[model samples]
Target chain A: EAGVTQFPSHSVIEKGQTVTLRCDPISGHDNLYWYRRVMGKEIKFLLHFVKESKQDESGMPNNRFLAERTGGTYSTLKVQPAELEDSGVYFCASSPGGDSPLHFGNGTRLTVT
Target chain B: SQQGEEDPQALSIQEGENATMNCSYKTSINNLQWYRQNSGRGLVHLILIRSNEREKHSGRLRVTLDTSKKSSSLLITASRAADTASYFCATRDPGAGSYQLTFGKGTKLSVIP
Candidate 1:
């Protein structure tokens, strides 16, 4: 089976712009997660979705970021008025269920200058 | 503060040698997982060890968890040059709730040919 796939492996945009990253999870996987890694930092969880409902979103950094998994098949993370601090790698992962190993995508590297 | 911290920020060894990495976490966790990421690639799940389990092995990889100490170790025997990448330890802490995973900074391992 194909692994999780992320769109636009790398994106460069000016600060204050809007960017959207997409992720397609593995087939039959109902659990999806979003994480990010800033420069020289550990990967941090952003949010999680169990099907179409969000199970956790406490990791979201600010109101400028929004994530949605409509219909429980794929996910998209949108950052409005992106800031310089938003430059990092955004990773999306999927798992069979709770307590299962996650399968990740190549990640979308966002560079907001 | 981050929940998990990986010791030895970087490691280098000759092929055919053994490589070991350690991770320490604060608070109780349901399970801990090890992941590998090659340059410019997504993370790949290496192995997972539950709090109740002490040690587990997969081919050349060996993982040991000490819940009492709140630490874990990953051992890769007969390492190959292809193994050069970053190894991260992620913990599923019950305190975090919702099956969220907290990741360590990771150990960048370089296996010399």
Candidate 2:
């Protein structure tokens, strides 16, 4: 089966601009998650989705960040009015369910200047 | 907050040698997992070791978990140049209902040919 896939492997935007990153999980996977790694920092969890319903979003950084999973399939992470600090790699992952290990995508590298 | 910290932030070894990375966590975990990420790429799950298990192996990878010390180690035997990447250890809290994972800073390994 194909692994999780993310689009626009790299993105460059100016501060205050809006950027959207997309992720398509493996077929039949119901659990989707978002994560990010800033320069010199460990990868941090952003949020999670279980079949279009947010399972957890406590890790979201702020109100400017939003995520959506429509039709219980693919997911999108949007950063409005992006800031210089928002420049980093945004990763998306998926799993079948329960405690299964996650499969990740190549991630989208966003550079906000 | 970061749950785990990897030892020896970076390592370099020649091919056919062994590379070991250690991770120390602050709390109890349901399971510990190792992942490898090539530069500019997403992470790939290497293996998972439960709290109760002591050791597990997959191909050239060997993982050891020591609950008593709240630490874990990953060893790649007969390493090859292709194994060059950053290796990270992630943990899932036993009491956390959410499946989000807490990751360590990671160890960057350079395998020379």
Candidate 3:
């Protein structure tokens, strides 16, 4: 089976510009998650989606960042007025729920100049 | 904030040697997992050990969890150059209804072939 896939493997934007990253989870997976890793830092959870509804968003950093999973098959993360700190690799993962292991995408590398 | 912190931060080993990485986390957890990421690639799930599980083995990978110490260790036997990558530990809170994972700063392993 195909693994999770992310779009625009690399993105570069101005510091004040807006950027959006997309993720497509594996088929039949009911759980989707977003995570980001800043340079030389730990990968941190951003949010989680169970089908079309968000299960947890407490990890979202600020109001400027928004994530949505419209049809529950894919997810998008948007960073408005992106800051330098928003430059990082954004990863998407999906699972079958329960104790299943997550399958991750190659991630979108966002570079804010 | 990151919940788990990997010890050594980095490691180097010769081919056919074994590599061990340790992770220490705070707070109670339901399970602990390990992941690997090659350069410019996405994370791949290595293994998952539940709170009730003391040890798990998958091929050359062995994982041990100690809930009382809030720590875990990942051992890669007969390491090869292909095993060179960053290894990370993630944990899910026992009380959290969502399967959100908190990750640690990974240990970058360099296998000298």
Candidate 4:
């Protein structure tokens, strides 16, 4: 089976711009998650989706960040008015279910200057 | 709040030797997991030890979890140059769902061949 896939392996945008990162999870996987690693910081969870419904989004940093999983197939993370601090790698991961381990994509490295 | 903290931010070892990384968390967890990532690459799941279990093994990897102490350790035996990567420890709390995981800064392991 194909692993999780992410688009635009790298993205560069000026501060205050909007950027959207995409993720395609493995086929038949019911769980999708978003994470990010800022410079010199640990990877942090953003949110999770289960079959088009957000199961948890408490990790989302603020309202400027929006995550959606439509049709229960793929997911997208959009950051509006991005700040310099948002420059980092945005990772997408998928798992079969709650008990299964996750598989991550190469991630979209966003650079907000 | 990142709950997991990994000790020895980085480690250097020789090929054919053993590498051990430790992790400690503050809150109760349902499961603890370890992941590895090559430079600029996605993370790969290594092992998962549930709170109810003390030890688990996969291939050359061994993981131990101590619920009372809220800590875990990952051991990679007969390490190879291929083992050079960042190893992160993640914790999933009860009812936090799989996406609510909090990850540590990770231990950068360099295996000199």
Best by DockQ: 1
- Order by lDDT, highest first: 1, 2, 3, 4
Question: Please, what are the lDDT tens digits per residue for candidate 2 over residues A1-113?
Answer: 89999998999999999999999999999999999999899999999999999999989999999999999999999999899999999999999987788999999999999
DockQ of each: 0.90, 0.82, 0.85, 0.76
Model 3, residue B67: C-alpha shift (Å): 1.1
Worst 10 residues of 2 chain A by lDDT: A95-104
Better of 1 and 2 by DockQ: 1
Model 3 chain B weakest lDDT span, ten residues long? B1-10
lDDT of 4: 0.92
True contacts kept of each: 0.93, 0.78, 0.85, 0.85
TM-score-sorted candidate list, best first: 1, 2, 3, 4
TM-score of 4: 0.96
- Judged by lDDT, which candidate is best? 1
lDDT of 4 by residue, B34-61 (tens): 9999998999998888999999999999
- Candidate 3 has which clashing residue pairs, if any? none
**Over the stretch A62-108, how does candidate 1's per-residue lDDT look in tens digits?**
99999999999999999998999999999999999978899999999
